[model samples]
Structure formats: structure tokens, C-alpha cells
Target: MLRTPAAMQDAERHTAHNYHPLPVVISSAEGAWVTDVDGRRYLDCLAGYSALNFGHRHPTLIATAHAQLDRLTLTSRAFVHDQFADFCRELAALCGKDLVLPMNTGAEAVETGVKVARKWGYQVKGVPAGQANIVVAEGNFHGRTTTIVSFSTDSDARADFGPYTPGFRIVPYGDLAALAEAIDEHTVAVLLEPIQGEQGVVVPPEGYLPGVRRLCTESNVLFIADEIQSGLGRTGATFACEQEGVVPDMYLLGKALGGGIVPVSAVAADADVLGVLKPGQHGSTFGGNPLACAVATEVVRLLATGEFQHRSAELGERLHAGLRALIGKGLVAVRGRGLWAGLDIDPALMSGRVACERLMERGVLAKDTHGSTIRLAPPLVITAEEVDHAVAQLAAVLAD
Candidate 1:
């Protein structure tokens, strides 16, 4: 194995130190594995922050990307590309929404939703401009844009990053009464992550999503689901909202929508809600480029089949059961849904980072999120055998 010191030295000298990543520099990857620069193999349990739902270098997605590249790679929103219509239509149909406004990243889609909600509040909901307030939950991660981070409750994300943007209010997650009290005549929308993926894969209390949806509907406030990390079969459903059987007024989707090839994100909602923006209001140059469109179309097809979703559900149960078997021995508790779960470590054992380092040494690669929790999200394509192998590694490492 490559010595960690050399890699850490190189990174400190070259790259920005924004993230404290594991000391493994991956050079290549496949369905469920990655080869580091030193040629050591490790199972990829983090899966590019849920962006690689289709796995690394998937043949079908790669092939389509290649062909589309050879044909037409870009044609900005100035005009139109042949692939845009098909992709938008397919994604909208998958979400059962009336329309979609494509963008290049999850943050952009989140910003688009915010803009649309505020405008709709003024024009449709009849609230005054600049007075349109959005209700957001604590510990939510939509993206890193200025406006998106403006609502964050994390000190690291918000500290000294201001004077912060305005027009947002924070609410305690999974608490319906707090959510209700946060609403006002100026409230335009309530934004939240369906499963809080970045916060140690925390699942909200049962009936939380449905309760929020009901409140939004009754209050006439737009409900927006930031499914950037939990959508596209990541949580054993097309969208995590499906688990609660509630449909939001808008869906902000990213990550897996690109099939692990390119950045593809979009906001899907009924025409009236998304219709507030005029032609010149907003857009991205590469938002609906031909190549991205073709790849995203195929990604939508793959997710709709529910094959990967089924695999996640089945394997997730086995993985959880196996991890739970080690609970009192080393772990604090197990939490999550589908293939995405978090294991909280006991203080007497190692910190999450120490455990992740050990797991990497043993050929499994997962990263820690919060202080003592490691988020586990293998590619949905991983098999039952692979799941067992991952569990075995965790069990072995914790046993030590």
C-alpha cells in the first residue's frame, strides 16, 4: 500500500484543503470497487456522495455519453438541443410533475426552487416581493451556494460566510409543531431533505414527511423536497418522499440523475408553481446540453424499472441486521433506509474517522460524516454477496 504520509504531503502542497478525505487517491473504478493510485482495491461504500448510483463507468451510460459527445456535446440555452426535450419529458414523467427546469448541479436546482417559490408567492400567492420567507429545517444540506448556505444551522457552513443572505427561517427537523409555528402569511415554501443524508444518514421520525406535507397543503405553503441525495432510487424508492406516500409541490433532484457521468440536476413541479419565472429570469449554460440530456434520459429509465431500488431494499436489510448483531459489542446504534445507513460508534471504541481508516486498511472505503457516525451508502448496483462482504469487514474491524 502507498504510505499515507506521501499522499497527504502531496495533497497539502497541491489541492485545496476543503475536505479531510481519506488518504486514498483513487485512480480508477468499476461497478462497486475502486483502485487507488497505488493499485490497491477497495469497495466504494460512499459512492461519490450518492452521485454514483449507477456505479463508476457504467457501460451503458458511458456508451451513450460517448456517442452523444461525438454527435453534439453542447448547445447552450441560447437555442435548443435535440436531447433536451426527451430528457426533460422523461424526468418529468418519472416525477409525475407537469414540468421541469434543468440545471447543472443540486445547488442550482435548490436556488431555482427558492426563486420560483418566492416569485410564486408574490404573483400567485399574492405576497409582496422581498417579504417572501422560506421555512427550512436544521441540519439540512441542499448544496453549498450562497443562498443555500444562508439557511444552514451548522457553524462551520455559516460562520464568517456572512453577511448571510436573507428571507429564510429555520425549524427543528421532524418536529411538526415547530414547523407549524414557523409559518406566517409571508411564508412561501418549506424546504427539507427527505432523509437528511449528509447528517449521518439520519431518518426523520416516522410520519414526519407526511405530517409536513399535510401542513403545507393545509397552510397553502409550497412544500419542496430536496431529493438531491435521496432520490433516484438511493433510498429504495424513486424519491424518498414515496416512503411517506406524499408528493411535494416541487422536487429538487441531482446526483444520481447524471448516472455518475456528468452533473445533471433539475426542479420538477406543476406549471403554475414553476411558471413564475420569465424567459430571462434564470438558466445555466450547460444545463440541458445534448450529452447531459442523453445520459440523464437513460438514468431515468434505469431508475423507473425499480431493479436497483429492489436491490437496495433487500441488501440494506441484510447489511443492517448484520451490523445490528455487533451493536452492543462496539457500535452505538444503526440507522438509515435502503442501502444508505449510518453506524454510530461507541466512544470507548474508535472515532468514526479511526474506524474509517481501519476499514480502508481492510479494503472497504467509507467516510465519516458527523463526529461518531459513519454514513454507509454503497452503489445501488452492489449485490447481496458484496453486501455480506462489507458487513464482514465491519464486523471484523469492530471486533478488534
Candidate 2:
């Protein structure tokens, strides 16, 4: 087995240099802990960017996947499989939506939602063809597709990725007035992340989501929530939008929906809204594959129990209380919801990347986004003791 630095160098030389990941190589994971190539263990505070809400290799999900694999892996949407309808029904029930369109990735789900919104705008909302407008919030990271990136506010993601797709309007996040002002007669939908995770877990101002819901309803515009990273109990709720008790017209869900095993995502909406697309209008070959559906069905059931959500809420309070106690010492601020937290370091102290490296050296793993903010989202299965250990390691790094 090699040390982390050696393995990291190998990846840098062989893999695409797209991500500036921490110099740690995990070889195995279970629950909230991971083992590096060198056999060193660390608390996985990042949890694959909230893709492991059920934790790594959750027994239920793995068993379901195994059984499904033994029975059937993929049938492609060209043919329906036994697992498809069950998955869709469970997901729709969990979401309290009328219908669900499965996809393989978060970006694909987002694309599905975008297509639905645009089509609904034309066919149902009666907006002119090619004139539909969707208002998006600033600092959003919906996906990497050209159309999705077109509305991105991050220069790094959008730079050199154009000529971008059109039909989008940008408004400052958490600013209801600006959002309302941006809406026009051609506006078909308003898309936003209930909590901006990629932007360092940037939670909106209180009541922002509720206000947006009202605005969308009043203006007769569809409200679409990109909950790819913040949904599925990541924010102490089935969906972050639920915190404000507002239901969007459609939901873009991914990340943990696959039970941290496969890439499973979906767009859930009412029949009239999602029904805009007739057969042959849109789909993916592996969208409703038997394997993904089998796994996701279990995932949806797990979310329905509210066990993970309650765990996140209780653990989040403890984690935040611990991190918040460090504020004004070395941490500038800590902001986030549920299991997700962002520790903003003071400029005078080490940068988030630096702190992350130091914490890794002390047996914990978390990722830094932007420059000064470290985002932590451990698997929901992590216990209070493990949370304490991770936080203690971070505190030790700050003290050093």
C-alpha cells in the first residue's frame, strides 16, 4: 500500500486534472469512516459531497443492488423492468409529487426539469415558442451541461464552456425583490438550490424559499428546486425546501438517491407539469434501468422513515454547536443546515484548504470550497462520538 501523497501523485499524472481534490486516496469505506491506501482510517466528513447520506455501502442498498444484479442489471427504457414502477411510485410518494421521471445523474435530472419547464411554458403556460424564460439564482451549480452551465454564476465553471445556451435570467440569491423584478410575461419557471451547497453551503436568508414560492405562484411561474446536493435528508429534511413548507412545481433530486452506490437521479413533479412531454419527446437509455430502480426504491423508503432526517437534525445541532464554539477564535463563521456545515476561516488564520490538509494529517477528511470555507457533510450514520472526533481534529488543526 502507498501513502496518500504517492497515490495522489499517481492520480494527478494519470487522471484528468479537472478537480483539485485533497491529497487523500480512499480505498474502502463503511458507514462514516474510510480507509486510505496505506490502511489509515479517517472520518469521512465530506461523504462524497452528500452522496453518502445513507453512508458508504449501506447494507440495505448493497443487498438490494446485489439482488437486482443477480436478477437483472439493465433493460434500458426501451423496455420496462419490474423495478421501474415501484421506484417511481415510492419516490413520488416520498416527494409528495404526482409523477417521477428517473435519470442517471443529477445533471440529467436537471436537464429533465429544464425541458419540462420550457415545454410547460409553451404548451401549458401558453408562452411563445423559444421565448420561455427561467429565472435562476446567482452562485448556482446546477450541473456541467452547456445549458445548465449557461445559468451558472461561477466563472471557473462557465469560462471557456460557451457559446452558452440562452433562455435564462439571473437574480441575486435570497433577494426576493430582485427575483420578482426579474420575472416577466415570458417567465416560465424559477430555478434555485434551496441551499447553495457548492457555493460553500450558502444557506439563504430566512424565509427566502417561502417568499420565492409565493412569488412564483403569484406570477404563474413554475418553481423548480435543484435539490441535487441538499435534498434526501442532507438538510435535516427530505428536501431543504420543506424547511419553509413550500413545495416547488418540480424537484431535481440526485446525490444520495442511489444510496451512495450507483448514479441515480430524478425529476419529480405533478402529472400536468411533468406530463408536458409525451413519449419519444425525451428519455435516457439507462434512465429507468432495473438495477438503479431497485437501489433507489430502497433509498426512497429509507428517506420516508425520517430516521436519517432526524439523525441529521440532532447531529447537526451538536456539530454546529461544537463548531460555533470555535467561532471568533480561528473560525470566522460557520453556516449551513443539517449535517452540512461550512466553517469559514479567518483570513489571518490558515485557509480552508490548509486546514483541510492539516485535519487529514490528524485522521479526518473534509473538503474546502472557494478559498476560506470548509464544507463538512459526514454520512448521516455517523454517531456523536465520531462527530466529536472529527471536530476535535479540526480544532486541533486550528490550534496548531
Candidate 3:
């Protein structure tokens, strides 16, 4: 027996069952590939669910992280660290927003967005106190926080975790009519993912995002785009909304914002919407710490250059073309934008889990979202040949 089985057993024995990861034990990773302890290499198609958009241990990100580690690391929210202002200012400028509130995770950013929206509704929009509600889309995967999950339509995420928080209304995704009907006088914000990553990378129909933007504008409600998984150059743009020519009231960002080095998330919005918060209202301890800010500032600068965005756009077309060619063979459908794609393997052949297991055996690492749907979000730094290699592995797996 190889060393992997024993390592896998040890991992399962010690950790919680929150994630059902593949059996491969990754020892190290660089760019678009990872190495197992047993010396096997695998193409990384998941890219840490878009968190590794810059690829594993990107040189610039790594250098900044290393330098920050040698200096100060944390100072909490009480005293502002040296790295905080640059990160907040640069990230805010990137989003075309006036203010940015840093947080530790995507879920915290969502929660912060919710709180900010409610506060803005009461303070700015003049909604009735305690009657503030937010509109959300079905099949959304914001995060697993109690408040965030309160609006979730997924039973797996919402069930057993509730006695849920109130003040959220669920509407069908990609349906402007349903969304318009769901919003009321008390509705403060409309929160949605431009592309639903966890829900099989579902893309809304054309004009859906712009329509949502229009409705939110007309209704005087905030349009908060949860771009945690779709932003930071994953969708051929700094944000997926940019593809639709829509600028939301707030941008909830995470994942790639930390350059896959540290946990960093933020809610960016204009002064009018984000300024509703006073000092004591909301904060995070390690949110804009020196280490996180050092890495993420470089992340913002990289994004500002628009290099990754262009790469994702060009590479995404090639990826989608390759995937669409396989639709009639083993894939039922392929959906996504930029470097992100969700492929539905024919269920008659195998489930997404089985297909992923087979792909792993063929030296590629991908993730399954739904029953027969697997998501492919390789790093933006991946090469054309690597893309072809990953697709070829999938083709071979399906053929077998």
C-alpha cells in the first residue's frame, strides 16, 4: 500500500466531516499544479474555488507575504496598521467605490453587506426600523454564516443550522419579474452572485443582470453583488458585473483578494451606502492585518494592471470551446465565464464524484458541485497547453 491511504485515514480521523475532499494528499503546489506526498503531480482545475486566481504561491504575492511576516503581522481593529490604508484605498479604487470595510472571510463580508444595507435602508432610505428586509436569489451560495444562510435557498446549507435569522426574501434567480415582485417597501437590498459558483457555475440569462441593476435603481434598493467567487479576474474582468456593464451599489469580495496567501475579504461601496457605519458599528480583528494587507495590496495592484483579467478572457474562450465540443459526448452542458466553467457529465455514465475520482487518477484535480456537475476554475496563470491537458484528462475519464 502507498503512503496516501494511511495519510488520508489519519486526516479523516482528526478533522471534521465538513468537507469531503479527494483522497490525494497535496504536499506542495505551484502555479496550476500540485504535488502529492507520493511524488505524483496533478493539474489544479479547482484553483481553490477561484481563491488561487493568481496560482499557488505566486512570486509577487509570496514575496510580499514573506516581507510582512518578517515585520508586523497583527494589530487588531483598535489600532490601524501601516498596511491597512493602502489595501483599503487601492481595493476601493479598483471597485470604483468610495469606502471599503475589510473582513476575514467571504461570509463576514456578506454579513457586513447585509448589516450595511439594513443600516442604509433605515438611515438613508428611511425604511421602518427593524422591518428592513433584503432580497436574495435562489441557488445562491454566499457563505455558511448563520445570518448569511438565513437567506439561502439550498436545503443542505440552510437546514439544521436554523431557527434562522429573519429579514430576507428569496426570489428566483435570473428572473427580473420574480425579483421585482419580491421587493417591498421594506426591502433594503438585492444580493446576488452574478455567476452562481457553487450552484454548478450557473450563469444568468442575458440582460438579467442589467435588468436587476435597473430595478434596484428604480426601487431605491441597494444592489449588492456577492463576487466572492467570481471577482478578482476570474470572469475576464475585475468583477463579473463588468461583463454586463453594471455597477452595483456594493461589492462583497473575498477569495482571490488575499492572493491565496491570507484570509482577506471586504465590502466596497460608495460613501453614501457604506458611510452609514460609524466606528464602533462593524470590524474584524485580523481583517486588514499587516500580513493580509501586504499580500492583498499587491493583489489590488495586479488587478489594476488588468493583466489577469485579459488572460482569463482569452483563456476562457479556449476553455469553453473545448468544453462545448464535449457536450454531445459525455458533457450534458457547460456554463460559466472567463477561466471558470461548470461541466455536467452525463449521469448515465457516472456521477460528478466518480468522474472527479477518475480524473484524479489521471492526474487532474477538480471539484463536484451538484449531482453530475463538476466545476473547473483553473488559475488565471495557467497555460493553453495546461488547459488542453486538463480537458484531455476529462475526455479520457469520460471515455473510460
Candidate 4:
């Protein structure tokens, strides 16, 4: 008897019923593929929602982790560690920012951004205390924190999460007029994903981000780009905003910063913007620990080479072309950039979940979101052949 069902059952029995995972038990992964306990091979197309952008157990990242593990691990936030400063400096340079405040998870980075923006508003922007408001777009997915869920448009994420925190104004995404009208003197920041990944890899209209930048500057409001999903070479550019020549006042990065070995996230900004916080304002126990810093430093080194970004740009064209060709066959629409794509299956035929189940049987692993939409965010390291294999698998599933 195979241990797959027993393992899956044990996982489902013990874990909270929050996630309805597909019926697959992966044992190990390398590069862009995973193997199950049954020795079955499957290409990993989801890449942990872009967290595994460098793929599983990348040699450089793993080596860095091992070396750091042998040296030191955690020192809390009370004492400084050897690996801290270099990681901050190098990552700040990569982001072209003056300062970097490290955190452990993407949600923590977002919370840090929110706190910083609110403080900057009162101390710098001259907004009254407790009156700061941050404008967010509709259909945005920042994180699952209570404050984040308070502003979410999704009923599933927001339904029972109240009494919700106030001070967020929702505006239509890709609509400049609504965004402009939503901004007021009390507005301290405009938080958005450069490309809404959870919103089905939705890209805003051209010039929309530039318009947001100009509007923020004109209104004396901070532009906070939540690049946790769209940054670090997932979008063909270092940052998705870079493709449009728009820079946010603060960049919220995570997912790939730890090189898929450990959790790492950060907020990068100029001193004038990120300088509002004093000691003891906000922190995490494991945030900026020696180990996270060590692994993330290597991740920064990888991005600094621009190899992954170039690969994304070159192979993205091929990936998108393949996906687009599936239109009218089984896909109703395809939207994304680089190796990331959100495919809308024909609802009249099958739901996204069923399509994913069928694909799972064919040795391809992906994730489905919303009702009929499935997202494909393969690792940046995936080869052109792997890309084609994934597309071919989807085409076959659609045909079936």
C-alpha cells in the first residue's frame, strides 16, 4: 500500500480546515518539479504563490542557510547580529532605497508599511492624530491580517472578520478618476499591488500607475506599492512598477526574499519616509534575525545579478504566447506578465477546481482562485521546455 493516502489523511485530520488543498502529497521538490511519496513526478506551476521563485532547495540559498546555521541564529531585536547590516544595506541598494526595515512575513511588511505611513502622516504630513486614512483598490489582496481583511472586497475574507478596523477607502482599480477623487487631505497613503496577483494576475491599465504616482505626489500622500507578489523578478522587471516607470514612496517586498528557504520580508524607503519610527514602535521577535538576514542576503545577491529578471523577460514572452494561443480552446481569457499568468477556464465546461484536479492527475500542479480563474506562477528558474510542458498539460485538460 502507498503512504500517500495515509499522509494526506494525517495532514487533513490534524490541520485546521482553512485550506482545501488538492489531493496530492508531495515528498520533495527541486528546481521546478516535485515528487510524491509514490515516486510520481509533477511540475510545480504555482511556486507557492511566487514564494518559491528561485525554486526549491536552490543550491546558493541552501548553502547560505547551512553556513549561517553553523554560525548563529536568533538574537531577538535587543542585540545586533553580524549578518543584519549587510543584508539591509544590500537589499536597500537593490531596491534603490535609503533604508530597509526587515520583517519575517509579507503581512508583517504590510503592517509595518501601514504603521509607518500613519505615523508619517501625523508627524510629517501634519494630519491630525487618529485621522489618517489609506486608500486601497477594489479586488486587492494584501494579506489576511485583521487590518488587511478590514479593507478587503472579498466576502469570504471579510465576512466574519469584523468589527473591522476603519480608515481605509476603497477605489476601483485601474480607474484614475475614482482614485483621484478618493484622495483627500486626510489620506496618508495609497496602498496597491503593482499587479493584483490574487485578483487573478490582473494588470491595471497603461499609465494608471503613473497617474497614481503623480496624484500621490501632488496630494502629498505616500504611494505604497505592495510588491510582495510582483517583485523579485516575477514580473519580468525588478519591480512591476518599474515596467511603467513608477516608483512608490515605500516598497513592501516578501515571498521570494528569503529564497524559499526561510520567511523574509521588508519595507524599503528613503529616510524621510521610513524615518518616522522610533525604537520600540513596532517589531517582531524573528524579524531581521541573523538566519533570515543571511539567507535573504543571498537572495538579494541573486537579484542584483539581473539574471532572473532577464530570464523572466525573455521566457515570459514565450509563456504568454503559449497561454494566449489557448484562447477559445478551453480558456476564456489570460492575463499576466512574465512567468505568472491567470487563466480563466470556460465556466460552462468545468470549474477551476475541477480543471486543477484533472491537471493534477496529469502530473502538473497548479492553484485555482475565485470561481473560474486559475493562477500559474511558475518559478523564474523554469525552463522553456517546462513552460511548454505546462501549457500542453493545460491544453490537454481543457480538451478533455
Candidate 5:
């Protein structure tokens, strides 16, 4: 018998019941595929929620990690390492920003962005001391941090988490008029996801982001784009904001930045906004460690070449076209851009969890979110054939 059952039971017994993972116990992965302990291979469509945007164990990223591991890893931000400056500089250049503050996870970057925005509001924008507010979309998913969840519109994430952190105003997403009305003299920033990944890969209306940019500029409020999930090569551009030709004042980035090797995230902005912090104000122990910098620098280099972005753009057309054909068949709707997509299966047929389970039985790995919606964010390294294969598996699952 395979060790899969025993291993899974052991994991369940030892760990917190936070995540209800699929039944597969993967032993190894490469590119866009993973193998179970039983030697069953499955196509990886979730792609670590876009963290593996470069694909599993990418050669360049792995090599960089290996090289750095042989020499040094963490320095705790106490002293600068050799890999630090280049990583910061290259990422800053990529973002068209003057500075980059590194953090370990997407949530931390969001928190960091919040802190900086508030500080900027006080020091630079002359907002009242404790009255600084941030306007966020209703269905936004920045992360699971306390401050982040405080403003979350999701009951699962917000309920029982507080006496929530104050000063955040929630407004309906894609409503330019509502957002404008919510902003006041105390508004410090407008934080939003260029494409909301968790809310079923929700894409806002076309002109929404550009309008936000204009409003933020006029109001002297920072426009912080939470690109943790929608950035990198997932949306066919380095950042999803780039799709709308909107450059936010601050970019909160994570996921693919670490090249699937380590937890790495950063907030990038120009000197005027980011410079609000002095040395002692904000820091992370493992933020810009040697191993993370080494891996992320290589990730930046990969993005700089624009190969992955191009692949996502071209392949996304094929993926979207294939999915759109399924709308009336079993899918209720399909929404997203590039290699990222959210498919809503007809709830009468199956829930998103059931659909994912069925897809898994057919040798595909995916994730479900919000009722009957399942998200597909295959790595940029995935081939056209693999993309078709995953879709065929979904069709088969739905047909059954």
C-alpha cells in the first residue's frame, strides 16, 4: 500500500486544522507537475497561489538558492549582506520606484505599506495625528494579518478577530464614485488589488484603476496597489496595474518575488513617500536575508527579460478562449487575465470543493474559493499542451 494515507493522517493529527488540503501527498515537484508518494503524477494548476509563478523548482532560482546556501543565508537586517543592494536596486528599478522595503510574506508587506502610508500622511500630507484612514475595496484580500483582517469584508476572515483595527473605510469595488465619496481629509491611502485573486480572480471594471490613480494624485493620498497575488508574471505584466497603464504610488509585492524558494515580499515606492521612515522605524528580521535576496534577485532578472510575461499573455488568450467555450456547458462564468483564472462551476452540478476533488481524481491539482468558484493560476512555465490537458481534466470532471 502507498504511504499517502498514513502520511496524511499524521499531518492532520499533528497540525492545526486551518486548511482542508486535497488528498494528494506530493513527494516532489518539477516545472508544472507534482508526483505523489504513490508515484501518481498530477498537473499543478494552483501554482502555490501564484507564488510558484516561475514554476516548481525553477532552474535559475534553485541554482541561486543553492549557491547562496553554500555561503550565507540570514543576517537579520542588522548588517547588510552582499546580495541586499542589488536585490533592492533591481526590484526598485522594476517597480519604477526609488526604494524597496523587504518583508517575509504578503501580509507583512501589506502591514508595512499601511504603516508607511499612515506615517506619510502625518509627516508629509499633514493629516490629523490619529485620524488617518485607508480606503479599501470590499472584497480585497491583501493578507491574513490582524490589521489586514480588521478591514476584510469576509466574515470567515474578519469575524471574532477584533475589536478591529480602526481607520479603514470599506467601499464597493470598481465603484469610482463610491470610493471618491469615502475619501476625506483624513484619508491617507487607497489600497487595492489590481486584480483580486481570492475573490474568485475578480477583475474590476476597465477604468476603475486609472480613476483611482487620478483620485489619489489629486487628493495627495498614496495609491497602494496590493500586487502580492496579481503581480509578477501572473497578469501578463510585471504588475497588474501596468495593464491599465496605472502606476500606483506604492506597490506591495510578494508571491513570485521569492521564486518559490523562500518567503520574500516588499513594498516599493518613490523617495518622497517611502522616505517617511527613518532607520529605526520599521524592520524585519528575515526581510532581505542573503538567501532571499539571492533568489529574488534572480526572479527579478527573469521578469526583466519579459519572457514569462509574454508567455502568460499569449497562453492566457488560449486558456481564456478555451474556458469561455465552457460557459454554457457546465461553467457559470470565467473571469481573470493572463495565466490566472477563476471558473464558476454551476452549483447545481457541484461545489468548488467537489469540483476540485473531481479534478484531482483526474490528475489535476487546483484550489476552490467562494462557493462554486475555483481558481486556476498555472505557472508561466506551463506548456500549451499542459494548459489544454488541465482544461480537459476540468471538462471531464464536470461531465461526470
Candidate 6:
């Protein structure tokens, strides 16, 4: 651990103290595993917060990125790049939407969705000018943008970040009646994550998503599903919404869409919704550039095969089952779908942070959220044996 201390200090010395990171200093990684500066390997259960659904340094994604790098990388939105068309078309088709607006980050996609929804409210829904309001859920995590955080319920993310933006109504997540009460004629949209990842992978009540879809349809309000952390085969299906057989008016997608190779996010909707933007009204200079398009297009191709989605589903059953068996043995609860899970440890025994540290010592890496919950999202490329190994390590940590 001699080299690790200096590297950790160097990491914190120049960077802002925005994150409380694990104490390992990783220097290289492959599928399902990473090697630290001291050459200690750990099974990666966090999977870059579900961004690396395909795993670290996935061969196909790296190859595509390399090929694109040799040809071209960036171009302004003022002009079209060669790889733009296929990327947009395939992604739109995958989402079953007619139009797409690509952006560089998940937050930008959310901001774009907010703008588009409001514009559509003015132009299409005929809400009074400057009166379009949005309904958001409590314990939701869309992004860290000022506008997004204005409606957030987390004190750490929301506090001291004001003067906050306005025109949003917050309601308890999974309360169909509360959500219904929040929407009205002035409401332009309902923004939510189908599965609240940061809120300990909290899945809403049964039929809640369908209820929200019905409510939005009945009120003519756009339903914006932020699938950044839950989409692209993370939750067994292509989307978490599909598990409930619900489709929103808009899909804010990112994370695995870029194959964890680049920062790429997008807003997908039909022409009537996304087309509300005129030429100069909304654009990103680095959005849909050659490199992003090329790499993301291949990413689309990978998802098109449906292999990852199926793998996640089959393996997810095993993962959840394994975690459930440990419920009374230090684990109090386990919640999630597919390969994603939030395991709640017995608080009397240890904090989630301490559990993670112990797991690191046992050669597994995962992240904790809330006070007692740790989220486990191993890469889809991980084998059944790897999953067992990760579970075994967690069991050992708890046993100690």
C-alpha cells in the first residue's frame, strides 16, 4: 500500500473534493476486473455506476473508438459529420422514436429534455406562455445541473446550490395519487427515473410506472423517463420501463450508450416532441460529432443483438437470489431488477462505507449509497463464477 497513499494524495491534491472515492488507486482494467497501482486486482461490481455495462476497455468499443480517432473526431453542429446519420437513426430506432438530440453528458440530455418539453407545452399543448410547470419525484437523481437539482430532495445535492430554478412541483415517488394531485393544466411534463439508482436502486410500487404513464396521457403532459443509469440493457430489458410495459413520451438516454468509451447522452422522442426545437434554439458543438457518432453507432449495434439484455436478465435472477439468501445473515434487504441491486446491510453491524472497504480487502469493489445500502451492478460481461465470487466476498465481509 506504499504506492497507493501517494497516488491517492496526488488524486486529491489537484482535484475538487466533490466525491468521496474508495481508497484504491486503479491504473489498469479489463473486463470485470481492475488492477491497482500496486497490481492488486479486484472484481468490479460497481461497473462505473452502470456506465460500463459492457465492462472496462470492452474490445469492440475500444476498436471502434480507435478507428474513429484515425478518421475524424469533432465537428461543429453547424455542419454534419459523416457518422452522424447512422448514429441518430439507429439510436432512434432502438428507442422507437422518430427524432434524437445528442448531447455530451447525461445532465445536458436532461436539460435538453426540459427545454423541449417546455417548448412543446407552449407550441403544442397551448399552456399559457411562461406558465409551463413540470412534476418531478422526490428522491430522484436526474443530474447535478442547477435546474435539475432545483427539485431534488437530497440535502447534499440540493442544499447551498441556490438560488434554485423554479416551475417544478415535487411529489413522493411511487405515490400514484400524490403524482396525480401534482399534475394539472399548467404541468408540461413528469420527469422520473423508472428505477431510482442513487436512492439505493429503489423500485417503485407495482403498476406505479403504468399509473404515471396513464396520468400523463390523460393530462396531455409529456412523460420524460431519464434512463441514463438504467437503460441500454442494464435492467434485463432494453429499458426499465419495458418491465412494466410503459413507454414515455421522451427518453433521456446515456451511460452505456457510448459503450463507456466517451461521454454521450441523448433525448429521444417523436418528431412532434423533439422537433419543437428550431435550428439555433438548441445545439451542442461536441454533440453528435464524428467520434461520438461512430463509437455510439457500434454501441447501438451491440445492443441491437439483444445478447446483453438477455444475459443481464438470466444473470440478474441469479444475482438477486444470491443476495436474498443473505438477508438475515447481516443483510437486511435486497432490492433491484436484473444485474442491478441495492443490498441493505444490518446497520448495527457495520456502515455501508465500512462494508465496501472490507469488500475491497476481499478483492471485490462496489459502492455504497444512503446509510446502509450498497449497490451492486457488475458488468454484463462478468461470468457466473465472477458473480459468485463477488457474492462470496460480500458474505465473507459480513461474516467478519
Q: What lDDT does each candidate get?
A: 0.90, 0.91, 0.94, 0.94, 0.94, 0.94
For candidate 5, give the lDDT.
0.94
> Per-residue CA lDDT of candidate 5, range 247-277, in tens?
9999999999999889999999999998999
Give one digit per residue, the lDDT tens place, for model 6 in 1-400: 3799999999999999999999999999999999999999999999988889999998989999999899989978888888999999999999999998999899999999999999999999999999999999999999999998999999999999999998999999999999999898999999999999999999999999999999999999999999999999999999999999999999999888888889999999999999899988998989988888888898889999999999999999999889998999999999999999999999999999999999999999999999989999999998999998899899999999
Q: Per-residue lDDT of 1-400 in model 3, one digit per residue for the tens?
A: 5889999999999898989999999999999999998999999999999999999999999999999999999999899789989999999889999999999899999999999999999999999889999999989999998888888888888889979999989989999999999998998999999999999999999999999999999999999999999999999999999999999999999999999988999999999999999988887778788898899999999999999999999999999999999998999999999999999999999999999999999999999977999999999999999999999989999888
**lDDT score, candidate 5, position 323:** 91
**Candidate 3 Cα deviation (angstroms), residue 116:** 0.3
Tens digits of per-residue lDDT, candidate 4, 22-81, equal 988988999999999999999999999999999999999999999999999999989999
Question: What's the CA error at residue 162 for candidate 6, in Å?
Answer: 0.6
Candidate 4 has which clashing residue pairs, if any?
A: none
For model 6, the stretches where C-alpha displacement exceeds 4 angstroms are none
Give me the displacement of residue 276 in model 6, in angstroms.
Answer: 0.5
lDDT of 1 at 65: 95
Q: TM-score for every candidate vs. truth?
A: 0.98, 0.98, 0.99, 0.99, 0.99, 0.99
Give me the overall lDDT of model 2: 0.91
**Lowest-sum lDDT 10-residue window in model 5:** 391-400
| CA RMSD, predictions in order | 1.2, 1.0, 0.8, 0.7, 0.7, 0.8
- Overall local distance difference test of candidate 4: 0.94
Worst 10 residues of 3 by lDDT: 279-288
Candidate 6 global lDDT? 0.94
